[model samples]
Target: MQKLAGVLQNFFNQAHAKGRLRRECFGNLIYYRLIDDSQPFRRGTVIFEEGTLIPGYPQIGRMIRLDKGLKEQFTKPFWAEEKVDGYNVRIFLLGERLLGVTRGGFLCPFTVDRLPDLIDERIFSDHPDFILCGEIAGPENPYLIGSPPFIKEDIQLFIFDCQRKGEFDYLSQAEKHQLMEHYSLPSVRNFGLFKAEDILAIKQLMMTLDTEGCEGLVFKEDVPRGKRSKYVTSDASLSDIQAMARYLPDFPPEYFIGRILRSVIFLDEEGISSTHELKAQLGSAFIDGLLKAIKQCQREHRVYHRFRCRLHDRANARQLLAHLARGDGHIQIVKHRLVREGEFYIFEFDKVFQRTTGLLGELLSGEMVYD
Candidate 1:
């Protein structure tokens, strides 16, 4: 018993030294959760799986509320991340050549030629040693708030994901931080996971980041799925991808039913001009978008969205189409080639997101309901 007690104490002491907290020490206690590390890191030093790799990560986009009534359906929160305003570069090895790419995945022309020898020469020769995922941030694209876009003399990389050769997830979160420090690499965060159980806290953090010019938050929890999954399940307000997709400008029509509100939503600063003068000018714009959406549906019936449609009175085809169109905060109009017969029309909100709030705002504002 004495020997066991000594061992447990030694283990806890070791964990504490490595930036872990001894949460609740009970009888013969032994357990820990990694604490946020205290250090500086560049972005892209820690890479997480993107939505494209959506497998075991069902939480990536699981759950749907297509059956909810029209009045209550437009309020789901979307699990959005700041589409980091920099080149979306990838770090991959081709045979022996490892390289970075433009957001479009192209081996950036100017970047390839001008990369500092310290970065290019080293990374190019040692490509097999690590996978570098970062952005060419400068006055071109500011990843930090209040920072202007890329500047001539100010180009650096922010590594968000770190994939070391053969070593992968073998280390605890703390160990990973230490390794990043050891390599002298710049990463996005110095800490591992920052948990926010309270919704208010979430909102505050999001607003601060948003106002500061930083992109949205990147939440990580221990949910056993991917880095982005666990939070999606534990947080219902975060998985409203479908609801937010409708207002998108270029989204497909076959994706929506009745009438299509919008083909796609743009996240530009101007955002949706609004419910701006819905009386006539804005209303006409909204109607125009809806009509166009209807015409699109008639031409193509394979939209990426799947909504539950019930044909009836209060939910009449035309009204349903109009309601859906209204939800988008934009408008689309169908031409004569599409609509035919009866006092009927098709409607589809698709995303139903508020242009002003973005999807997250709708979730917080009680505008878009989620499951």
Candidate 2:
């Protein structure tokens, strides 16, 4: 254990020294040694290697503008896979043992404990050089509201991509499917292929998934090394909006702001111009119920008088704060000050807001990228 800790510490030092890792601050959260996207992950990427756990990155999708449309984004046929609403994980075999890693390249104790039970040991033995990337979701997942609520026995790996060990290249979609079937591993739902003209159909499919309580869809190119993008569902928007205001005191303002901004993007993606249309599309009563729940939190202005937020992405946060200052009728910025603290900017603010609506609008105006 001590040796592993020392090796991990040394790895962090080297990554920092080489400028391969960065401290990315988002909202009130500070992510240490985040993967630097500028320097792409190559073979032998130094994910921590310790007792039965080797943490690494999972293939992630880029969020593109909905206005671009799926047909223009990629070539003819594209694979539209169901975007599972759960924690991202990478499962790999190390010697005789199997390990589970979070999307952030950390050893996930929950997945490490539970993933092994769902698979036959021989799968790892048979395919020693492949890393399976998927989601570890169910009741205990802290990050998302599980759709189709996973039963204990049903909470297993939902393999989406397979990458060769020590290589950035992934197996072809057909090969991946065959491998999963051969190994008896579960995979996410794949909506076969859609042509360039099938954008409307894809949109319908996304809406259908949203109605059925699924997160969204991930469109990957039919060919290898093709373009990939995701369309998040309105269900995700509703949950995020609720989390934004409900956990205001606990989570940073920018974090809340990011979620709100995503709501705006959600509107753009779904082709909804106004909130009334959104309410009707997502069910008027459902929106009312969520707004009512958030309103209760908004009414408790006295409880959250002064706040200190740590923003890692200060540039965007500042823009957002400035935008909020300009337009929002409620939520007056009583006092706003910032101090640099290493990779983070500590922001102190005093706010008095009567309605949450203004805050929500301000957030929607804030342009930020999703990781």
Candidate 3:
């Protein structure tokens, strides 16, 4: 363990000096997280002091044209699963403890506290070395504002992939399904298997999901370590724009532009020539979101996204707040934000986007500036 620690320390020091790594701790576990890709390691990779490495999840390329994307990307049958709208997390058993690590490699205290409510802990007991990759989504989730329409209350976990520790590849689809069934784990809804040429059927499925107000679909090849691609619905794109429009300055121009393009492509491919309703919806997404931000700033003197989550332990709630406080000074958590409600502690906070807040404040105050 000492030799491993020394080697890890040396690598972390170099990476930290180069602005590519960050070091943090939760209890007795000291870990190094990659902030940027460095040769063998991808961004969000985490390495613990005892030498457990949780590799970063790879980015899946988005496909605008289903017909061309499927043919060009997959040579074999692929499974189409619902691409949920939520923050990604990787859960694994470290010793006898189950912990949740976010995609950016941070040890999330909130997720750890809520794990039992989300999944069957016996899965970890059965497969001690398996790392569960899943999405935790709902209106009450702390990270994201958007949630699937189905989850009306607290967050829910939907396991999508599983990988063993020290292995870079995910388990085969069949293997993962078998384990999920055995454990009765909540998983992303599967739309069945499809060959590359099954574009019509896939399109029909996409339309159904869109009508049902789902995020989109992810196409994962049947084989182990197979390639993956994602395609989102027009409503999802519009919702994303609506939610983030208040903090538009915080994101790149391509963020909004890409969604617009995707929505257009989806409409065209679906052969929807009448776009009056869509145009109105898209317009309201931007206009209404910005209007709400203006009203909020006028009333509260600040603009932010309010987050609410519940934890079983009060200490974990405090710890989660502390962890968020360590971020880029945008979090606002008051003493009254953490309150006990029956058996759980409800915590609420706001993530202030200073760029948007400042910009709006200036504009509201009649400060003229050249863009």
Candidate 4:
């Protein structure tokens, strides 16, 4: 299954770029929820048969709501590492050629050229089929956050997750360290394991990285599934907002409004009592730009058609789509269709104003690394 998945991944990747595949119409990151043979439930229509590979959307957390007892949830153990404020690049060793894929699985030229030299050739030899996932960062990253330009040597490929060549299965922490040591590749700063009850301490630790212009911290489990989540800094959030405005001028009003609410939520989570302080920190220009973008989006909403998407789980899909439509009052589900394929329930949602920018955003966010 893993081998086939790898082959299919590479094939679809190249095929989609050449306009030979229609799967790109669905989204940038095609997720396949692989069903087991032993399971009683019939499998849904998916590109892959092994496991799910949903889009590259980050799992956002509620800062204030989770603060109450969320800190105690990690009493067992969790691995934390500094989140780099750079583009996500997944380097694959395919045959003799190295491909740098963006979060959306598109070939990236910038990462391919800039990062290959930094990796030791012998590491590829050891793991013939391996996926080295990391952030291509530094002052000269040339993406996302802009900083002072630096030499090529200054650019860093901070490997965070080492996975099986095509599949998303991650290597153990010890294995990752061994691989990094063998190749002499630098990694994101690791905070090791923490069992402290004080969530405030974790926040403080993240703040120190923020002082250094770092984005945030990613938490990983020690055991199976290796669930990963991130806590981003306000500075990082602001950068993302600005990037959205500068790049995606036609995005819906809901997107900007969502970010605005997030801003307020994050500020309140930080215990800021004064509205004046929050307003001053957010800046009038930033707020004004978002408001302007919202108005523009509102104007566009008046002339939109229903967007559609297919999903395997009906209830969950409705909830997720409804959640996405919250910020922008314009986007709403007009219809829902259910197709029963054996025992599986296939869901289809007709939404107002479907945009392909979701995939485009993921693609353009990083430079293509290819031949």
Give the winner by lDDT: 3
Please list the C-alpha lDDT of all candidates, in the order they appear.
0.34, 0.59, 0.87, 0.54
Task: Highest TM-score: give the candidate number.
Answer: 3
What ranking emerges by TM-score with the best candidate at the front? 3, 2, 4, 1
Give one digit per residue, the lDDT tens place, for model 4 in 1-371: 25346655675455446544333211233333222211221122123223323222233343423255246345566788777766677676555765565654444444555554557767778786677778876543423334312222246677888766334357888889888888887788788876445567776786566556567777776666555656666655655566455223346667667667766666667665776854765564366544544454455532223323223344645444443454345445454565765544444444443342333333445746465
Select the stronger candidate by lDDT from 3 and 4.
3
Relative to the unseen true structure, what is the C-alpha lDDT of residue 279 in candidate 2, on a scale of 0 to 100? 63
Q: By lDDT, highest first, what's the ranking? A: 3, 2, 4, 1
Q: Looking at candidate 1, what is the lDDT of residue 18? A: 69
Look at candidate 1 and tell me the lDDT of residue 304: 26
lDDT for model 4: 0.54
Residue-by-residue lDDT tens digits, candidate 1, 1-371: 12224544464356457645323211222223223322221212221111011001011222121112111322323222332334545454434443444442223323433344215344435445555555555442211111212234335566555455323332334544565566665545432333333444544444444344453344433332234421111011111222323344443444442122221211111133553332343234445544544444445532223232222232234433442343233333221122322432222223222332243333444685657
Look at candidate 4 and give me any clashing residue pairs: 31-53, 32-52, 108-368, 108-369, 109-368, 109-369, 254-328, 307-351
Better of 1 and 2 by lDDT: 2
lDDT measured at residue 149 in model 3 versus the true structure, 0 to 100? 94
Minimal lDDT window, size 10, model 1: 50-59
